[model samples]
Target: MNPLHRNKFVAAIVAVISLTACSTPDAAGEPASTTRRVTNAEHELVFHVLEGKSPALVLDAGGGLSSSYWKDLAPRLAKATGSKVITYDRAGEGESDEVSGPWRVENAVSDLEAGLRELGVTDDVVLVSHSIAGEVATTFVNEHPGRVSGAVLVDANVPDFFTDEMLTAFAPVVEKQKADLLAQPSTKKNRQLLAVMADYAPVHRVFHRRAWPKDVPVTAIVASQTPFTDSPEAAGLWRAAQERFAQARPNRKHVLAENTSHEGIVTERPDVVTGAVEDILKIVR
Candidate 1:
């Protein structure tokens, strides 16, 4: 079969295997909070506020994942910092409405801005972003400088390494799986979600345009193992991305966790992740 047909075939198989077969409702209960929908000139955004005391922190989850993924991480950061926490599902990933086109970095930033406005979180807020969220958060800070007090990147997405060849290779894969991927059951939804992320070169490029603000203390934690090492090239790509962050923000300290994967920062090393948040709080305070 030709490459195009082969990709479609693989996508079909992935769709069947990756359907949301395991998603369970929010067991933690109705979020103990309410979500406000903010409709922008172009998109609609959904966000929930976990009220605390002051100096609110907004949490953005990784790619192909929902805000619920940060369920454990958010409260821990909130309690540790003694500040309000906001976590929201970006469009097409969680309870939030999906956008008509591919998720763009600018759109994600706009969604975050609209959500904050709708919730009335106008203070100097700290934006905490994980994985791909690092890209979105950085863009937000650059676009709206004064709006952000500081930022903490948990295994952030770095774009300097996402070359044109990588994006071209991943585009057909995403186009083929776009449909069934969305229909996936909540549990298995991450399969197609990952595929879509594979095409997110534009989002990654946004990260290269700006560095973490000097006024904003940036914290990054890298996982021990690289997850997408299907090939040596893939492994190098992942390492290059991490290296870009290290090179760009040489002064920024990074904590490497052992026996951990990409999601480990949020799942296995909540203590470490929370510790980093606390460190940011100290600097910002």
Candidate 2:
């Protein structure tokens, strides 16, 4: 890989991996309606639906992750809210087929759209996005408009979080690790990481410019110990972006997950995630 591309990949992956690694939850008893593969172009994306009712909850995981992240919470959310809960493994992750080339938010949104339509979930969606998947949720909601009833962003990245300054700050650290990142075994997750990094800056720039639909109610749950532990300045920027995004339009709110880390929020502070989603469910209902 080119040095510049490598650097970009490293910069974004560091922040992403720091907050994305976790043990897959046990989904054994989930009230699954179906766990099937949906075709998107040439690749097959796996989707697991915990059946219930309309205004479904769609959970999108962060980079280098799979739907297994929601194993524990999906069923709980379904039982508590009595609304369908959906989780999927994006292409190149989990059981989904990998497609060559850089990761693109547009393609992700397309895959999601196709899968939902196949499942007969055309509208009344309540999106729950985490980390990099925030970009996916933002684009999906915007493109589909009335299809989405609301959204809950769980310590997810807001476009504002990807400022030039932060990218600059990432350079020194990323450059030092070039030899190591290149040397790591090329597993599926590693390949996906590289693809995301290859297109991180440019893709996020577009996301930064996107406006979340004004009518779509949202709640942003931000962790106290964010991904940027090494740099207080960067961490401050991350939190501030969440604040701004929460206040960017009406029907949006921000909740602070005190003492929680980004990676653990979904598991450790699932109540916060569930509570936020339920809040939106109330509004849309």
Candidate 3:
């Protein structure tokens, strides 16, 4: 090799080592990261990760939504709480690969769990489950209680909260609604409304047999306005259901968000959601 070429090669190797050395690791002792990816059976999920302090936060977007849904909010939560925050797209949503069939509830939960595992997050996290994403968030916590310290349910879909009669009536309507949503160009293709309709009964049956663990802190932020409300009675039922979620465990609180509806709460009501997250932060620490 020529002498000049050898010097250039040595310089490039030195620069690479220097860059690697300069990178820092966050509290959980994992290397500092702002973005990552995790693959499951369905797709490889792209995740936005900001390593803050400790006890990270995971942003779970509602069904028919993706990590982009939390784009504006995840950063705020990380800043406010000074804790790591994670947001990602499920299969058939955002940048993740699409699935062949409908979104399976259990599989969705597994995808979330798999991502966190791949990230090597040793510390516990608070789940911010919005809209339809609530199912996977709650199910993840319920299945892996110790891994999750708390959860902030933002108008989440807690299957056990819906009555059998309610599910029976809303089933077909929701199915058609999702099929229409999937056909639209602007939607997230989460197919969440359909996933809920499919798993509501069995998920409820499993959770009903076992009581919610009282040790985990849960703050249920119930929305005042919801699309589901066609009448005063419908709105009232929605509030009642959220309240029930708050009381599911002893270490839980219910707060009614006055200004925003279900979807808007995630973006429009930052104070409401982050405040709840801060409360959970305090409770956990």
Estimated TM-score per prediction? 0.75, 0.88, 0.78
| Tens digit of per-residue lDDT, candidate 2, span 40-129 | 897898888877888899998888889999988888899889898899999898989999987888899999999999888999999999
Whole-model lDDT for model 1 versus the true structure?
0.65
**Residue lDDT tens for model 3, 113-135:** 88888877754888888766766
Off by over 4 Å in 1: 1-32, 42-44, 164-207
State the lDDT of candidate 1 residue by residue for 1-285, as single tens digits: 356544643443232111011222443522235566667766566676666665788988876678888878776776677688888888776777666544567877887887787777766888778777877877888888888877777766655545666555666665555654556664435543554454454544444556666666676777776554234445456667666666565446667766677665678888877887777777777
The better-scoring model by lDDT among 1 and 2 is 2
Best of the two (1, 3) by lDDT: 3
The lDDT-based order of candidates, best leading, equals 2, 3, 1
TM-score winner: 2
Q: Measured by TM-score, how close is model 3 to the native structure?
A: 0.78
Can you give the lDDT of residue 22 in candidate 1? 24
| C-alpha-based local distance difference test score of model 3 | 0.67
Worst 10 residues of 2 by lDDT: 17-26
The 0-to-1 C-alpha lDDT of every candidate, in the order given, reads 0.65, 0.80, 0.67
For candidate 2, the TM-score is 0.88
Q: Candidate 3 clashing pairs?
A: none
